[model samples]
Target: MTAVIAEEDINRIRWHCRRGMLELDMVLARFLEEHADRLTAPQWQEFERLVSLEDHALWQRITATSVTDSTVERLLRGCIIC
Candidate 1:
């Protein structure tokens, strides 16, 4: 069974979703609104990793403008923004 994400964790992730780029911010926000509550622990970890990336790197992954790590790539593919 998937573990429930903690409220504190969700809030933290929500804050991290705010990006320097407006386009990136919009995409991440939409993904969070639609999927944050349902993310499994592993997915949360992957998402945290994704958010930790520099803005350009994260945007590249979202836009498929450059190659990304497979795990993050997979997660991006599942997001509504992708």
Candidate 2:
């Protein structure tokens, strides 16, 4: 909660990341909580790009089951253990 993200910004991102799927919500929210504070501007841009994806596509990239792009996959590699 103490990340550089202002309250409004966090809320906006939270809203965007809030998916109907519980698993998606948890993983994305947790990533924001744990890593948001340390993210550089470029990382934030990448994250915004990732979150903008549809739930299924984002899940695919995060899980590596059907990676469409190596760049996004690489960005999330460290955050996702699977």
Candidate 3:
């Protein structure tokens, strides 16, 4: 079964996707628009963890300069920047 995320949670995630960098914002926004509804439970958890990261760290992951959890890695790979 698909993981069900509450609308409020999705909204919260969207808000957090707003980063200090424009590129990060665009990349994350694209990812959410394309895949938020399709994430599994563990993926959702990893996504939350990802958004909690500082902008630079998150950006590093987006640019493939740093690696993180596999689930987060896979999710980010779906992003256009990856």
Q: How accurate is candidate 3 locally (lDDT)?
A: 0.81
lDDT of 2 by residue, 1-82 (tens): 1226577876888899999777788788778777777776666777888889998988877877554554435646556644
lDDT of 3 by residue, 1-82 (tens): 4699999999989999888988888888888888888888988888889889999988777678456568666667667563
lDDT of each: 0.75, 0.72, 0.81
Tell me how far the alpha carbon of residue 28 in candidate 1 is from the true structure, in angstroms, after superposition.
0.6
List ranges where model 1 is wrong by over 4 Å. Answer: 65-82
Model 3 misses residue 19 by how many Å? 0.8
Maximum-lDDT candidate:
3
Model 2 stretches astray by more than 4 angstroms = 1-4, 65-82
Give the RMSD in angstroms, all C-alphas superposed, for model 1: 2.9
TM-score of each: 0.77, 0.73, 0.84
TM-score for candidate 3: 0.84
Candidate 1 colliding pairs, count: 0
lDDT, candidate 3, residue 61? 73
